[model samples]
Target: MAKAFASQGDTSEKNISFTEIGAGIWAFTAEGDPNSGVIIGDDSVMIIEAQATPRLANKVIEKVREITDKPISHVALTHYHAVRVLGASAFGADQILMSDSARAMVVERGQEDWDSEFQRFPRLFEGHESIPGLTWPTTTFSRSMTVYLGQRRVELMHLGRAHTAGDIVIQVPDQNVMFTGDIVEYHSACYCGDGHFRDWGQTLDAIRAFEVDAIAPGRGDALIGPEMVNKAIESTRDFVRSTYQPAAKVAAKGGSLKDAWNEVRAVCDPKFSDFAIYEHCLPFNVARAYDEARGIDTPRIWTAQRDLAMWEALQN
Candidate 1:
């Protein structure tokens, strides 16, 4: 079943494209907005990456309704990001799954992340009142966990740190479909505020090692073929490199954050100018890049006040 949804901003229905990439598998994409993927197994369904709000998650459930009425048995959070996990209740899954590191992040700064993200991206959280509470994973693993929904194999692995300390990817072996949470984005700008720039590159390499036919990334379009998959992976790789090198140079030279931001804009803007959310991500990305360059391990907590201060300092 192929369907499309057009919102107010997306006058063209083509903005959102839903496709059955493999047997009993689907990718729900809306331009560069957040994306969700579905896997219907022998008896139950696994909903990956709950959308930012219940309203958004409904859009995913609507498509699942078209194919099969199997109840949502499990909900998986690729990492602990407010926009990703806060809507877990909407899925109504009996068990929620995530990496151990992700669970730790939730415990460490879940409240601050919730408040900070809500303040930054109200568009993603339309009906905050519906969010029951902070989502907690019922099941968590250290490195790799293989889940069996009867016969379908859903492999969850923590390859390396990328978007967040707990960043993980979902691989459907039979379908050859991989759901790379925020580890790999299609055309959307890579959000690195809580990312490890060095470890992120290795994570990308690990993701590419899998034999994937299609990919449902955390954002942007659903990559259908190997070509498109490679393109997305490389695009993500480029974003990370562009951010890291300049920040590293600034750190080496004892240059200020402002100077590094200037260098990054000079390099990245010319190439990634048309990417979605490029403007919104650059400030945050640069801030994290600067921190990593300065040898700051474990990203600093981002409160709303700190976010505004950084935005004002960098953007202005």
Candidate 2:
């Protein structure tokens, strides 16, 4: 291979930050790693997007402990990705919630994703053995659902497909803060292995319509104030468009996947080369963009073998 496969070369630990974006809403971020949201309600707390394993989830729990002692009532998974959902067991919340589509994806390719992700980035899965099995939601809603944590109202809604088919955003009406799983990233690359490039922008539009005050995004730093929030949304939109446009054009002209990849790199590198996980996510993003442009609506399941095959092919 030309370089390390995915993030295998990334072994150094990142400094973790727990920032309060709203009155009781916290964003747990680690450099550019996957993030988790903490919503402290009047009586209890609700967590959004569990980390990859129990060991990592404990980091978020430790931060949550610094604020309040309210028992975690619910763990809301924004999507069905292994890096996000596999850590649900660590929370032990009374209710593990997910969108109906997310639950179905769990049934469809949960194990495959776990295996693929673990192999791609071992640093995120520090304590892989601790993850009992595929995490399943205790409850699921089709479109949207409102959960009142005491007096706090948290709304989970599937605005549209972006990061994944089941991606959902958590909105706090009172504070006007939203926890957008992987739909909106701040100075970080969007991992689009299973993303819907066509629908991603529309999803961002739906979130924009809310005009929220702050957002605890899927990765990078927490966005506070409208300036930072809008910046992240538009940058994310640019990242997605920059990645897809070149690849789509290549596919439109009956170019090979390698040709599409080179074109995508030519366009995306100048703008997003410094983004977190840019190199790790590029190949998969290009492959999916090519597929989507070629009329593949649903993303194919990525297994460990497929990940290696794709990486090797792209390396050449």
Candidate 3:
């Protein structure tokens, strides 16, 4: 039997965990689902990665209320995926922040991406109607920006592009904790539908330079300790390299995209089959890697129509 498209069959709810990995830094993880970060400063809170909808974000808010009553004053997005940014309204943050390039992506393909993602993963958008349409950042920076929540300092830096052209990491320099959006995944599969494989590897190297005690990834459990941190980064790099290299090899041989897709699944599935969303991401990952290997640097927009067509062509 053919597999379900994307995450359509993934209706089971995951157990959420709120872990404190640093001084006032919390990681809100939901069993390999989209994860969030809560940085409680001396005065207020800074949220990283809004959930898929206002309804879903409320759960995170409830968790926050359990810890501190400080109003959430800021939100930082790592990239422009719908599941990550569409829930901004629930936070009531004065400053919704992202890299300027991420803002450009929102302008370029945000609507199509929203449609595509919603169609691909209906379970994630349970309260789709609550979404106030496309989310835009109130503050945009090019390279890096620093914010002070009273005495605590949070640094937002574009470490280099990986998951998206404008991926950024929120670093609590003093605490040595990093909230890496989708740039890195632990046991969860890396979603590379809009990724730059070559650039992603280099970006991982840059992330390795940081002396981190804990990391809050886009998905998966909070990685605590330098050992686990290195493992996650290396595992993420391995996933990207392993997926792309085989597809690139096939493309270089002038193989069909379908052939490359099959090749990637054969090689990757054995190693990554148990990872979260591994099945949902493989087709898109293979498609993007095929395009990139064929010298297509920029990823094509994935509208809902394009999504179905590509899935059918590759998987059916």
Task: Tell me the TM-score of each prediction against the true structure.
Answer: 0.94, 0.99, 0.98
lDDT of 2 by residue, 52-80 (tens): 99999999999999999999989999999
Give the lDDT of residue 245 in candidate 3: 91
CA displacement after TM-score superposition, residue 294 of candidate 2 (Å): 0.5
1 against 2, candidate with superior lDDT:
2
- Candidate 3, pairs of clashing residues: none
Q: Give one digit per residue, the lDDT tens place, for model 1 in 1-316.
A: 2121112133232266788888999988888887888999999999998987787888888988999999999998999888888888988899999999999998999989998888777678788899888999999999999999889999999999999999889999998999999899987889899999999989999999995999999998888889999999999999999988988899889988888899999889888878877877887888899999888989999888887788667655
Supply candidate 3's per-residue lDDT for 150: 91
Candidate 3, run of 10 with poorest lDDT:
1-10
Q: What is the RMSD of candidate 1?
A: 5.3
lDDT of 2 at 268: 91
TM-score of 3: 0.98
**Per-model C-alpha lDDT, please?**
0.87, 0.93, 0.93
Worst 10 residues of 2 by lDDT: 1-10
Each candidate's root-mean-square deviation in Å?
5.3, 0.8, 1.1
Candidate order by lDDT, decreasing, is 2, 3, 1
